[model samples]
Target: MFYPLKFDHKYIEKVWGGRKFENYREDMPEGKIGESWDISAHESEMSVAVNGKLAGKTLKELAEMYPQQILGKDIEIEEFPLLLKFIDAQAQLSIQVHPDDKYAEKYQGESGKNEAWYVIDADEDAYLIIGTEDCTESEFKKAVQNDQINQYVHKVKVEKGDVFFIKAGLLHAIGAGIMLAEVQQSSDTTYRVYDYGRDRGLQLSKALEVIDFQLQSGKRKGLKVCGEDYDYSYYCLNNKFALDIINIKTEYEASGEEDRFYILTAVEGQGKIIWDEQELELSETESVLIPAYCEEYKIKGNLKLMKSYVPDLEKSKSQILSVVE
Candidate 1:
C-alpha cells in the first residue's frame, strides 16, 4: 500500500521567519513561518502522511510500524536518521553551534546534529556568518562574553544553488533575506553562542566547549555537474548521508540498491514519479518518500530536485564519481 509517501506540512514559527514559503503552500502559521518540517520523524516535530491508507499517521509511527520498509534494512535506529526542512530567514538567526554525536548523547540524551544548506533563494544583499578566525581559547572565550564575536566570525555572500556542508561543532548562522533547504541529522540540540541582542537563551559555555576554534572558512566541496547526459551534481557525500541535485530532462532511473529509503524534493519545476505502473505528480517544494523496499523508479519530465538518502560510503564512491565523469 506504500508508494511514495507525501506528508502534511508542519510549519514552525520563528523570530526570524518570513512569509516566503507562502508561494508554495497556503494555511501557513500566522506568525513568521520560519521553517516547514517537510519530512521529519523527530520527537520534537513529526510529519504525518497526507495520502494513501497511511493518511493522518505520524512519520514516527510509520517508521516503527514498517521499520525495514520505511527506514531501510540494517537501519535499526529508534528515530529517523535525517530531518529535511525549508528555512526562510527574514532576519538573521542566532549564531550557534551544535555538539557532535558523542557530546550530544552524553549531555542532551539525543543524537548530535550535522547539517548542510542549499541556498534556494537569496536577495541581492544576502550573506551568512560561517566559522571564525583563528583565536586562542582564552581570547575566544573573552569575545563571547563581551559580545564581540562578530569581529572573529567569517562572512560569505550567498547565491542561488550554493551548498554549505555544516559539520558538527561548527559555529554558523543564517543571515537575513535567505531561504534555504536544510538536510541534517534529526537532532535539534543547538548551543547558542550569540543572539545579536535577541532574548533567546545563550549557551556560551556549551557552545565554546563544542566549538572548533581552528575552523577556517566553511567552504565545502563545490557541487559539480556529472556529465552531458545527466545534469546532476553530487553536493555532499559523507558517512551520514549523500545528497545529489538531479535535473531530469527526459527520464531518470533510481534503484533502491543500498536497501535504504530515499527522500526526493522537487526544488524546481514539476514531474511525474513513475514506478511499477504507478505515477505521482511532484511539483516545486513538494517532497516524496520512496520506501526502502521499492524497486527501480523513473522520474520523468523536465524537473529539478534533490535526492537524499543514507549511503554506503565505500560502495557508492565509484558509482557516484562515474556519473561526474
Candidate 2:
C-alpha cells in the first residue's frame, strides 16, 4: 500500500551536456562543495495507489498490468498528465515551438504542449529566448531557411526564483548556464527551428511542418503574481495545464478545491508539508503527490515551490479501472 514510485530518465545528447548527479553519491567532505542533483530523469510517475486503493504498480507497467485500475477505477489516472523535469542547461538548447492541443489533435493526433519554468540557477548574462521582435511568419520562415533564426530570436536575462510561462506556439529556448525545474503538459512535441548546428545528424523538414506562422509568444509583459501574506510573492500561470508558484517562508498554507490531485515539487529550500494525517519534511529536490481528497493542506518551513495539476481532467471516471495494462 505504501511504496515509492520509480522511473528512469534516459539521457540524450544536449548542447550543454548535463552532469551525472549519480556520480556524486553522498560524497561530500564536510564542505558543501558542488551541486547535488537529486531529481531523476524518470519516464513514469509510478502509480502505487488508485483512489486510496492499493494499486501497487508503476504508471508504465500498470497501464499494461492493470489497465482497469488506470482506465476504470474509482479515481482514474488515465495517463500521466504532465512530464516534470529538472534541467541544468549548460548550453543553449534548440530554438523551437510546439503546437497547442487543438493543432496537435488535428495534425499529429497528439496532445499539445504548455510548459513553465522555475529558474533555479543562472549566470551573469543568462537569458531566455521568448519570441522575436516585429517578425512575421514569412520572415521567420526565411530566417529558418537561411539558418539565421537565432540572431532574430529575442533574449531575456533570467535570475533564480524567476518564472517563465511558455504557452503552446511560443517560440522559445533556454540559454546556457541556467538550471531550472519545468512542469509541462505530457507531450514531447517540439519543433526545433534552430539548434545552433550542435547535433551532427539533425533534421529540419519535420520541424518546419509543425511551426506555426500565426502564433507568437512575445516577451512577457508580466507574469501573474500576488503577495503571499506580507513578505513573499506567489504567481499563477495556466493554459492547458495549471501551475502555481508559492514562495514559502516560516509559515504558509495552500488551499484548493477537490477538483483533482496535485503534484507538489519542492524546487527549492527545506520545508514540511502537512496533509491529511501526514506531515513530511521535503529536501531541496523532492516531489510528492497530494491526493485530491485532502482539500485543506498547509506547508511549513522556508521554501519556494512549483505545484502542477490538471484543472479539469476530473470527471474522466470509469466504473472499472485497471492499475496497469
Candidate 3:
C-alpha cells in the first residue's frame, strides 16, 4: 500500500524573496516567493500528498494512520521530525538565532531548530552571516543598542555547491542572490537580532540568551565514497538528522531502512526513481519521500540529489568510520 510520496509545495512570500524559482518551477504564485516548503509536518504548515493513492492526505494524517510504514519504527508519531524547503533570497535575511532543544521546549514548547543549507545557485558576490566575532555578552548588547551589530557579525563568501550546518544557538543570515535547499528540524521559532531597519520587532533578550559566542561557521566538505556509477558523501550527521549528497552518472541503487524514512531532493538535472515496476520523475528542486517499507529502488539518469533522514547515531558513525579505516 505504501509508495514514494510527492507533496504539493507551500510557497511563502517574504520581503527578501525573489523570482529565482521561475527558473525551475512553473507553479510558483506571482510574488516574492522566498521559500517553497517541500516536505513538512509542522502544525503551522503541513505537506499534503499530491501523487498516487495518497493524494490530498496531509503528512500528519499519513503519519498518524501508518506511523510504522511512513515514519518507521524508530521515530515517534507525536510530530514529524524534519522540514525541507528551497529558499531564494533576493535581499539579505534578518540576523537571527535559535534556541537549543532544552531551551526551546521550556519556552516555545517546540523542538529546537538545527538546519543545513546546500547551495544550489549563488551570485558572484553572494555571502552569508554565520556567527558573531569574539565578543562578550556585554559587548554584544552594546552593539545592538548602538545599532552596530553588523560590526560584530562574521560574514563569509558563498558559492554554488557549498554546504553549511547551522546548529541551534548559532547566529546566521542568508545574503541576497542565492538559492539553496534547506533541511531543518520542524520548528519556526527564530529570535531576530537585526533586520536592517525593517519595521519588525527584535527579540534581543531571547537572542542574547541563546546566542553562543564561541560558535564559528565553516563549509562541510564530507568524506566521499565513490561507486561504479555514482559518488556519495555524508555532509552532516547528528541526532537530529543526516544530510548527504549523491551524484549519479548513470544510475544508483539503494534500499530504505526499516527503522527510518528517507527524503530525496533533486538539486541538478533530472531522474526517475524505479521500484517494483513503478517509477516517478524527479526534477531539480523537487523532493520525494521514500517510505520506510520500501525495500529497494533505483535512481536512473544523470543528476545530483540531496538526501536527508533521521539517523541511528552510533550505526551512522560506524558506517562513516568504516570508510575512513
User: Which candidate ranks first by lDDT, i.e. highest?
Assistant: 3
**Which is superior by lDDT, 2 or 3?**
3
Q: In model 1, where do residues sit more than 4 Å from their true spots? A: 217-229, 276-278, 321-325
Best by TM-score: 3
Q: Which candidate would rank higher by TM-score, 1 or 2? A: 1
In the range 137-187, model 3's lDDT, one tens digit per residue, is 899899988999988999989999999999999999999999999999999
Off by over 4 Å in 2: 1-15, 20-56, 60-77, 200-203, 209-234, 253-257, 274-279, 295-298, 312-325
Ranking by lDDT: 3, 1, 2
- lDDT per residue for candidate 2 within 8-119, as digits (tens), equals 3333444464563333223223321222222222242333333233344444554445434222233355565566666767777778888888877787676788887778
RMSD of each: 2.0, 8.3, 1.0
Clashes of 2: 23
lDDT of 1 by residue, 1-325 (tens): 5668888888999999989998777668788889999999988889999877788999989988988878887666756799899999999999999899999999999889988887888999999988887777688788878989888888999987788888897889999999988889898899988888889888988888998977755545655665544587777888777888888877888766446888998887888888778778887788988888766778888888888888878767887677568
Q: Which pairs of residues collide in candidate 1?
A: none
Question: TM-score per candidate, in order?
Answer: 0.93, 0.71, 0.98
